[model samples]
Target chain A: MNSGRRQFIGRGGAMLAGLAIAPGMLLYDLAHGRPASGAVRWGMLIDTSRCESGCDDCVKACNKENGLSGGTGPADVQWIRKLELKDSRTGRGVSLPMMCQHCEEPPCVDVCPTAASFKRADGIVLVDRHLCIGCRYCMMACPYKARSFVHEPVHDQKPDVPRGKGTVESCTLCVQRVDRGETTACAEACAKAGHKAILFGNLNDPGSEISRRIKAVASTQIRADLGLNPGLHYEGL
Target chain B: MDLLQARRDTRIFYLLVGLGALVVAAGLVAAHYMEEYGHIVTGMNNQIVWGMPHVFAIFMIVAASGVLNVASIGSVFGKPPYKTRAPLSGLLSIALLAGGLSVLMLDLGRPERIIVAATHFNPTSVFAWNVFLYSGLFAFVGIYLWTMMEKRMNPWSRPAGLLVFVWRIILTTGTGMIFALLVARQAYGTAILPPMFIVMSFAWGLAVFYIVQAAMYGWNEMELNPAILKRLKNLLGLFILSVIYLVAVYHVTNFARHAAFERFILAEGGIYPMLFWGGYVFLGSVLPLFLIYFPRLGGKHHVLVASMLVISGSFCLLYVLIIGGQAFPLSIFPGYEARSSFGDGQIGSYAPSLPEILLGCGGLGVSFLITTIGVRALNFMPRDENTQAGD
Candidate 1:
């Protein structure tokens, strides 16, 4: 090929590449390097009676969105799991998903040696992957069994949901989606499944749907006596 | 002068050094594999996050704090008999701490990132405070050793020893609080854990000192002079009793409210109950007490055996506390029968893998190596009035 033709092709490719990346650059600006605000507290509420015992769309959706392996093994990581409670005498069973109950006074945050386990300004508890030394103190301190240490080498991780070996992890209330003014993957899946069991909203806003529902019903926070003041709520025994 | 080394069989010293090196190398290899493969290669899972490595690490750290009791008595309390053994006491403290801290750092999922612990200070974190507490122990004990060894610095030994004695008490409290302050598990969450650990350290640390002192004396074809043996054994007996009392209080206090949890440890939980009764309560506590306090069992030989039993019991006791405490499921569903595929409300089972055990043994190897080298190179041999003034 002639030098002029080759140069023209290369220039065209460069322009195409820049065109492809311009949207991402704008999105990065859209991300705007903004800080999580303390004024906005993200939360969830679950109506157990609407949740089906056999259905686990939330778990599947979480695995798919978070790039988890979806294995139920002793060593496998579970951002969320179905916990079934059975009354011994009555044989009445209640099923609900258990996960990180983002608390106002998170025990995990208090015990972390590196301050790797931290609460964002918006009251969403998170582990700073950079600082976490895999001490698992947060795992030990968590009251809800919300955390899981990555036992094996993680492969095919979703770019948005970063995970690795040795470090502890848990449900983030789908911070990535929440950051985009979207709801969690689990909540969306639960609603799509027609259960409408999970509710994700801003607890900081008195006008939010979750706030209205919690106020309307006799919803309760699991382990309220611990006084963690969890953002998550549940209704029905 | 060097009864165990210069004039006697240096062959044993080299042999032990070789053995210790081999164990350390094996541990490094095991640690490498764990790091390479992730903790999935080991028995640890989400449920039993802290396992055997923790048992060894905590034992070594606690024993390190307790080992200073010898120096405290000699210098701070101004006991001449203990003064002769002060240097040896300080040396063992450094050795045990180094070993314990090594295992702890290496066991992390991201061991390379351990420096982050120091850089990012979490004021509320007990573990973060321990990073300073543990490092300070090495520094203060090192200074204390210097004061005892350097004739010119003899005047400073008391102040330095007093500082170390205080530091050690705080250090053990930090270690105990690692579990004590943990409210998530049923087995922990009492303020008594700190005191319980301090008392346990007294027994465990003295137990370690006795074993090392015996070996050193035995290597020289000498016996621990019966008078010194009597005083030490009496102290060990008292410490052992204190450990029992504190442990009983911890369990008894749990009975009224946490009865099921207490029963799970005492009887219902299969391996836990067995280890508590057979390994810790009986073998570690009862037998050693019998050996130390029994009228006819006051011989030097009995003390040596008793020390071995005490050390064994230390391992069993720590395993029960660290691993067994973790094995009990969390109280997620407080008042109902809870079940999950994730082992919620289920007794978490963990069997230490070979690599994990080696990683733990490696800590012992490091301790052993340091002691062997320290004794051979320096005047760490206990120089009480009963023995010839080797110095």
Candidate 2:
């Protein structure tokens, strides 16, 4: 073969190897994801007026996404719950979804002996599976009762959401999807259900849709008396 | 007196040790099963994360601190009678702590991963501080015990005892703060809890000491000195009254800000009310006082009965405080009536399963086993001075 022809074949072989390794590198990037940026403080604003009391699309979406049993039993782990409330004096009825508030100073993080319950710089609260001793001190400390211990063995977990028995778990704000630059399963599902009540975005960006809407309305954090400064808010509640 | 009597004593000792060993083995097996099946086999859930095991473990832990007060009276306060009982007091403290800690460590969802607690510490966590406090208690108390037991170390016992005395208060404070530091819970979160726990420890620990001391004396067919008996019972009576006083203060203070919680704990909560009023107040406190202080009724057996009631009362009070505290619904929305699928605003329920009970019993068994072995091997018995209280 001519020298020029041989060089061209070698180049072609190198191109083939590159094609094979490209997908692997992309997967590696996905596997060991870049740390969530400090610039973005993610938050949610719920318009209770638009939220239907009977609708449970948000809950179902979360269960499906997180691979939870979604059972209503006392032992079953659930990330979100819908609360029905009636004012004692005025007889006014109200309804809203409840989950981890992802506080600025989370009590769970404060009480966890092993620092397993932690808050990311971006304000996402999470349990480090490797370190959690399952003492459930966080469960006791939480005013909202948002965290749940895995009471039974877990099976058929989503590959992205690795769950185990004998560990405390709660909403991660759909971290897997969030890391992939997608909105939470619950918020997406609620939007799909035509409620348009659940809005998720970066509160730091004043130009973002959630920020503009929050600015336009009076939104209140649940248990504002606690001064948890939650990432989630409610409007017209 | 005879070979047969000594042989009989050995047989009885073995029997007691065997019983304790059996219980410990069973408890360990139950814990193993819980680890295998997950907490699904246990009655504890997300709402009531702690159950019978915590009750037993906490009781032992709190009482362990209180038991050391006997030694403190001798070594720290320079009391003659309390000084005589100091060695046995030290032994009980160590034994009880061992049992309590064992149950606490084993009950974790990931009991095998408990080393993570030591490796990754959160400074803000009361539980983490407790870890250090508990180990410190063992170290300091061990040193204190050594000083008391060793001839050359006798002079050091006073300082060691002083250090242990101070460390134990901090340790008990850490235990009480486990609940007191919680910002949201109504049953806990009171500044008064640490003091309440301290007094409670005194009563509970003394009651335990009485029972054990009585047992040891009975085994040797010896009579407790009348003056020592009188002083101990009177001290117990005072501790009981202190406990009642603290309980009243706790309720009254809570009533002002948290009327609903007060209502739930005091009256509206069925078991809670019953446990507090009937179980703790009447049976554990009042009846015991009557038995201890009643004119012409201050027999040894009567005092023993009073101590028994006090011990049971401690359990009743703690049950109301710990389990009942969790049972009451959280006032997430103060003015609004709330309902939810996740038991929001509804009372959290718990019924301890067999494994949970066994795990707790196993912790007690561990204490018993250690005490039995320690008492048998060591010169822990108290010899009557044949003089009065001040002697």
Candidate 3:
């Protein structure tokens, strides 16, 4: 009877030990090593020539996918929107979608007091809604004017997309969608019309479409002199 | 109780309750009308996101920092005038904070959920620390007023006064940090703002006290001796000098650097140079100095005018900071640098809309209303054993 009791206790202890070790092993895999380099440095390239000025299909897709209230308005809470610019000298017009550039040295991240706004290992700049105070400092810090304050209370916020009142928000590069092995709303919508103005892929990978296009096209980062090194690039600007 | 005491007490209660009710009513009217119409009714837009609310809120907050001199006078330096008035000063600080926060709430989109500001704290944000510090200061001022000053001084008074003294300095620094920490903006992001804010606090606080005292003494049919007035004027003169020195240093350094930002600040096309020199530095600081320092002309009327201008100019300084910062947009398109947004694009400019102005005016009303009631009810004006208090 004593021998049987000892065997039962030892087995229970062994199971507990394995449970403790499992999380650490997972952490290590996520931190330093991943199979197939699942880690991706997400980037975007926009071809302004192909983008239609006022067609807001990407904006609509983002709003619907995020389940944002219609009252939020495109002007106030723009995750993506088409900007029309008129040249003073030539009177020429330029149209393109504007969103977070996801800068390599994002000013918004530098000024966030709680470190709630941070760049992911894959170079996606995101706001942790749980930690935002809506002080609007990040809005001021962002040179791209990419951040927006939540001015109205939202109802029926999509469970997949975090939302809160009295908080600052901006584009997350569609992190949730990326986790599901899907493209961003803007990219998906733009692709349907065979326009594909926005190309998203890992900049580090030489074989990726983004890398290839970047090499081939005359592209530039918006306000590169600011030294933000934004991952998003504009082709034929 | 005696008839005189009975009448005084009755008058105090009525005014206090009446003013409190009025503030609440005005708040409701503003929140309802403004929110319904959208912030468009106020002078604000995407171009100038903040406006009068920010100016008024900051003014009251900085004044709250200044009111601490009352405690400092009593304990830190043992200055007789402020030392004796310590308790009243503590209460006044709380009153200023209440007025300021009321303005902030009226400006918020979700005033009902302002608690979210506390629940969510972003460490990288100076505004985040401001939220925390403002709340902490409010609580500290409240407790200090109630337990230590409301009654008479107890053993806790000294320690409470010391704690408050230190906290007020931090509060002012945090207020300055709101602008100083922003590296992107050249107008405010210098090491100079923190000290400038502290000195400005002294000028503002003393000016407020002088005006209130003059008004209160007149109302009570009491004579305010010229000696006391002279001392107040002297302090005001000193603060004005310091403000002038700081302004000169800040602008000179910026101009000397000759960066694009420096040109933006000092140049004619930008609004900051106009506001800072024409309105704040020269008009606000220098004009007041002339009024107070020209010994021959430094009479009561001169001192009063100088103080009023300084007060007005201080407010203009806050406006210039907020508006000037936003005027320069970030997205300066390459290969086509046609002077950025304001200089070329005509993208956006802000003017405080009606609701914005009304809410801001209401904030001033709230401050005065509180000061009046507090003076009447709480004996805010200190009692000289040789004379009556608030009479």
Candidate 4:
């Protein structure tokens, strides 16, 4: 009985040691983990034909998800906005949303003095708040007018989307959600509102929904003549 | 001849320094208020991120490079008359740069993170290049000044001056490229901008130098020789004409490629057209040209008036360029007019607030104070052979 008890004690100690080493191995992987591979290129497709006027569901959802409040001043921070367009020649109008195009040759990244503006391996462009000097050169360089300078101090920020005053910001394509294998808030919100206008998927994957849609329909990039090769595309202008 | 030995502790000197100090104090206070309360108090918004502060800062920075031209002429070209003015040119360059850089740093939303700007570099960025150029200018100019002032280092003065001359051109090129490299703005993306800025520095720098030289002469009860005065005025006239030619070519080229931008700047733009025609063309270019070319109407006084007008016009021209460029909506959708909460398809409006004006004036004041102190402590007075002959 004493020998049987000794064996039981030894086995229990071994089990405890194995449990202790498990978390350290997991942490090691976390520390040395590489960024998302270039195999996945995130992109979006918008069908303006299905978009409705006066529907700000995407904007509202983006604000909520990013922890932004409505500001009436000229210097207000807005990551995404709905634009109403009118063609002078035809007198025809359409409503569409405009945000960061996330171009392959982003002018904002090129003009930033501190390398604060950077593009991820997955093609998501972001501004590092710690390094941005608020020179607004990036704002000057953005052709889409997609960037907004944070003129006021921010309070009650979402932990995931950290922002501060004097830093330039733009649409992140819901990078936090994308990392978790979820669709962007703006895309999800549009579908939930029954518009079904925005489509989000990997551009690199031919089997992805965005790729299939692009192959099926003729899509246009805004200011395509600039040769920036933007990730965002629209079906109807 | 050493100015430091001269009795410089006069009531007028103290008065000038005190006034300049007050203006600098006012600017600091305004910058503090802007940073504390947020940029909401100012006219700048998300649409017009850069405002009046940039205009002043750019002018000072450009003029700083240009002001060194007098020294370049002396040391590089071996001009006898300009040799004596080299020390003053060096002093003014340092002063103006300090003032301009101060305003630029103060205007930053995160001024505390300047160390990051200095450390982290983006090779593709024009701004990143400017960081190296700006610091290098200070260091090189400082060395050049030391070489000029120290009798033992006189042998090295010519080489140091040549190096600074080359550096200033590169520096000005970088400054011009700040706008020229912008593919986003229709008014900016031209190769001529760098050369235009180079000529602009020549014109603006000479004007500033003339004004300060006149002030110093007046304080010392000295007469500026007519021969030297004529040479300076003629040089100013030539620079003004070159600027006019460049301006014409820039507009003509822009009109051919970017018709919409040209139309907005030349005709349809509300404040832009007015500022362009009334301020830049009329006051900055034409009036100064007339004042410098035809001296009979105002005689010697006309030179001073022309210089002042030239300076004033530079401000207007920069305002039209910087503010006007941002005011026009971006042509994202070529065929479609855009309307949004962010003021899409609409011209952005800006009105300079009190704080902004004070901040600009403070830069001027800082330069003025430095010039005053520098002239008192250094032998910056121009002593031409002709003046000495008269004596």
Candidate 5:
């Protein structure tokens, strides 16, 4: 019995040692080869008071730009949305545009098993469609419920945008538009109205409108207590 | 081959597999149609973003993890009744894991790429560690069970089983930490989640075992020992008490401060209150306790019924936790209502679409089908070897 137990212990130790080695090896390579770096920090400032509840122009613009229908369905994706709200006590109604807040310390990035959900050097929280396993832990970990899983098979999937079933997706902060040195679709739409409810700039840059407004007003980060330090700021209480 | 036993087992296995396959196919077809039509097929939307599938998946995973408790008692502690029941306990652990993983795969958008999760390594991610832990734990249990099958148990079996036990606890912690560590979310943050998971695990694990044992025994197989049943019931009873205590403390402390979290979960108008009362407290925790502890009851079938109730309640617990956490909006905009941002002065609504349900259900079918087939092929349940000779 003693020998049997000893042998079991030894074998178990060996198995665990093997598991430990695999992760250790990966960490070594990551540390040596491709250390995380700084890139562009895509930040947004949304003045909720400026948003119109009746017109989903931002949602429409995003859908059109991303080849989506402004339809309400699981597969009918929403990159940007206008959500209605009412006063908690008095019951007065208003609308707020809901999208990915793109946190500097993103929970999705912290929970992804495949490193598919990552924060770009420039501070944009994005998902690598190719690498994403669609485990939805990132979705679960995301405090805002900002992430959505593509539950159905995709039809007419654009070549440029590789959306698929069994994968999670959310606001990419318009990576495609950013790649082209352009403003986000929603930001562009908000810009057209000259209300500037949506402001885009480098969060790191002090002179940027986002940074300036963040400094100028008593701006708040939604779920600020979460400690996610979201790059997106909402101004005007 | 005792043609009778072989034939009976084969027939049962085939029937289960066939039925599972048919349901899976039907679900897939429905899912395909729903996806094509859009997410309107099921009862979920932004308000109630989580529904039956989410509930089912969490239950399965919790149930899967719970199976380990029995295995640990028998294999690790070497206690009476539990020691004799090691082989059966081990087999049940694998079976429950199958059920859990199945739900996960179907719940996913890209279940096919699950393999990639194993291949890619993300150091900073808790979910990444979870995938690794889950794989290792499963492999260890599988091998340990295989080792125990031979008339001469392999020297490796005990240690492998022990490792699985330790790893499973860690895995359960990781699962809980997925919520508790979310400092960003108001609903979950207490240090109690890990211990809560542990308590929940034992309750869920014992409940599943009770039901499985009853089914395996048929109407009157009588293979299960009365002593074992008594011990298991006692342990389960203890777990129920712990679960109640922990839940009370978690809520009471949060409520004392009148925190938004407390208001969200306990207040009359909030979704948190509705789900906590409707799902977790009454269904999962309270009723099961009554069934387990009440007088002149807690017999085999009663225990089985109680276990089923616990399982159902546990599923609801996960549902309430996952969905309820997301119901509150992150932004605290000025001149806006505090709660209305979640939806139109209501909680965010969600229902699992057909594809989501199909995939979730398919995961269950797959888990059952796999366990049924694996047990038949791989000698999962331990044989007496020499029943006439006492240990």
Candidate 6:
């Protein structure tokens, strides 16, 4: 009876000690800022109805952020662009911003020879500049027409975006800012321009603004029949 | 019968080699310029990424695999008539592949990062698989040639030849999958492409072989046996017919599933339709068929003319398939007309510049130079006891 009581006390003390260390471990993790996990899936919800025609602020902002300027030729790079769509049947016109769809099963990733095209755990698709061999096979595989091959040598590149010639690039959803716990440049620009058309947030979090909007509204993917499960969803396509 | 080395100390041979080397040098210069400046110098833009260089590179690579079929027929099938020609077939496969691979490598935007491609591999990519298949082809063909030439190694010739034949099929299939596996393109995403490429390799490869054989005969001041010539011409005709049949089936299938793509390629596809009908069908296929069949109209030069037509037609087919496929606007927004900063919903245009043309021709020059050197070093000429008896 005495030994059993001592064993119970010992177990209770060990449990108390574990409880004491748990809060400190969590505080350390919070202080260090743990890397983004797969549990948080980033996504975008675009309300085309709210999008205004001839408003290229989002495109311009993306360019400024990514340092894509001075060349607008057919061969020049365009990470994001404003697309005007006119319905053939209804003759109704609408404008929207187009960029990489960031599919869960990205075809670009599948066709890349050097595994340069990849998707991060947080659902952001990116091209690894170091690994890219500039074969353009990924360009051919991309259905969204989001990718662009750097045909000429770039000058005055932003320090954050290290773009160079002979490599394929695409919209990274402002991954640098996202990593720093901020939204994409396009989304911020859209909101700043008094047009809250683009909403960027964590899709996995039910409480996130984008996720709530998607659940409340009917959102459509560009080519939904392809079953790519794109992270970018659109209302009023 | 004894094998004899070609005469190396000839003025004509030296002139031919010099001309080939000059062309290859020009190609290298063009590649250097493109690399130094950027792809902006080329006609290829955002829409049309691949251009003339791909057409030439793909053709040579496909033909390289096809040419090896001759040796396979000899060693694998034990065909007596084809046995003597196996050595030349093996040599041509290596030479043509080297030429094709050189063009493909030079056309890369980051050719310097070739080591990255070699070291880092993505198993899903057909291009990555092709790197392995292409290098393996060279090694296998080399071993196959060695087995055929070396007396002691002759015992293993059949097995080596069989392995090469199987490898070549996979190589051509991978090449076809490069375009076909893309679900994004309306012109691609079909199972027919691999088989079509296989048949194309057969036709194009045979055409290359016939031309080389004819040239070797001319160089030796000899004539091919009438029986052998007849058999080869008939085989070429059959291969051409097979290609025609495959093309018809592909169009019919596309018409049912992708009518828009079919209309773009077949009916209203400006240069594409013309190239397909006039170049590939009429001049490449139908005309060759007539020459091979009629014989009287083509006279003694029927084989040469037919082979030339086939080669020309192949170039046309590849151009239409590669360039035309890219020219058609991508269907990003179905049922809606799209306008953007990029050329969305607009037909893209690509005109091959002088540099691209020079680079393309350099591949041919490389093959020619290699062929000349190979024949000069070793006896790749076809020999027939029956022909000597007739002489």
Cα-based TM-score, every candidate: 0.93, 0.94, 0.77, 0.93, 0.79, 0.92
> Residue B12 error for model 6, in Å?
1.9
- Docking quality category of candidate 6 according to DockQ thresholds: medium
Per-residue lDDT of candidate 5, residues B1-391 (tens digit): 5788778877877888799888767656654554454344656554444556666666666667777776677677765355545666666666667666665654445556677777888898876777777777678877777666765766766787688788888888877776677664556666778778877888887887777667666622546555455666777878877887887787787566436656766665355566677766787667766776788776767677777877777766676667765665443443455432224234555644556667567756765666566656654443333332121
| Docking category of candidate 4 | medium
Q: What would you estimate as the lDDT of candidate 3? A: 0.71
Question: What lDDT does candidate 1 reach at residue B375?
Answer: 93
lDDT, each prediction: 0.89, 0.90, 0.71, 0.88, 0.68, 0.90
Tens-place lDDT digits, model 1, residues B1-391: 6565564467777889999999999999999999999999899999999998999999999999998898898888887778888899899999999999989988999999987988999999999999999999999999998998999998999999999999999999998898888876788888999989898888888888988998899876775656777888999999989998998988898777678788888899888888888988898989988998888986878887888888888888888888888888887776779998799889998989999999999999999999999998999988666543221
Where model 6 places Cα greater than 4 Å from the true spot, the runs are A1-34, B1-9, B295-300, B386-391
Q: What lDDT tens digits, residue by residue, belong to model 3 across residues A1-237?
A: 999999999999897787677854665556874432336778899998888766667777878888755333322566665676667677666777778899888878877766668888888899887665444667767767677666555678889998865566778888888776778988899888678888888888999989998999799888777688998999766
Stretches of model 2 off by over 4 angstroms after superposition: A1-32, B386-388
Candidate 2 lDDT, A135-218, residue by residue in tens: 999999999989999988998999999999999999999999998899999999999999988999999999999999999999
Location of the lowest summed lDDT over 10 successive residues in candidate 2 chain B: B382-391
Give the Å error, residue B326, model 1: 1.5
The Cα error of candidate 1 at residue A152, in Å, is: 0.8
Measured with C-alpha atoms, the lDDT of residue A108 in candidate 2 is 96
Task: Give the residue spans of candidate 4 off by over 4 A.
Answer: A1-34, B1-9, B295-298, B386-391
DockQ of each: 0.68, 0.68, 0.19, 0.65, 0.26, 0.62
State which candidate has the highest TM-score.
Answer: 2
Q: Write the per-residue lDDT of candidate 6 for residues B1-391, one digit (tens) a residue.
A: 2233333436678988999999999999999888888998899988999999999999999999999878887889877678788999999999899999989999999888899998999999899999999999999999999998999999999999999999999999999999899888888888999999999999999999999999888877787787778778888999999999998998899789778878988879899999999999999999999999983754437888899999999999999989998888888889999998888988888989888889999998999999998998897887987333221
B149-194 in candidate 2: lDDT tens per residue?
Answer: 9999999989999999999999998899999998788888889999
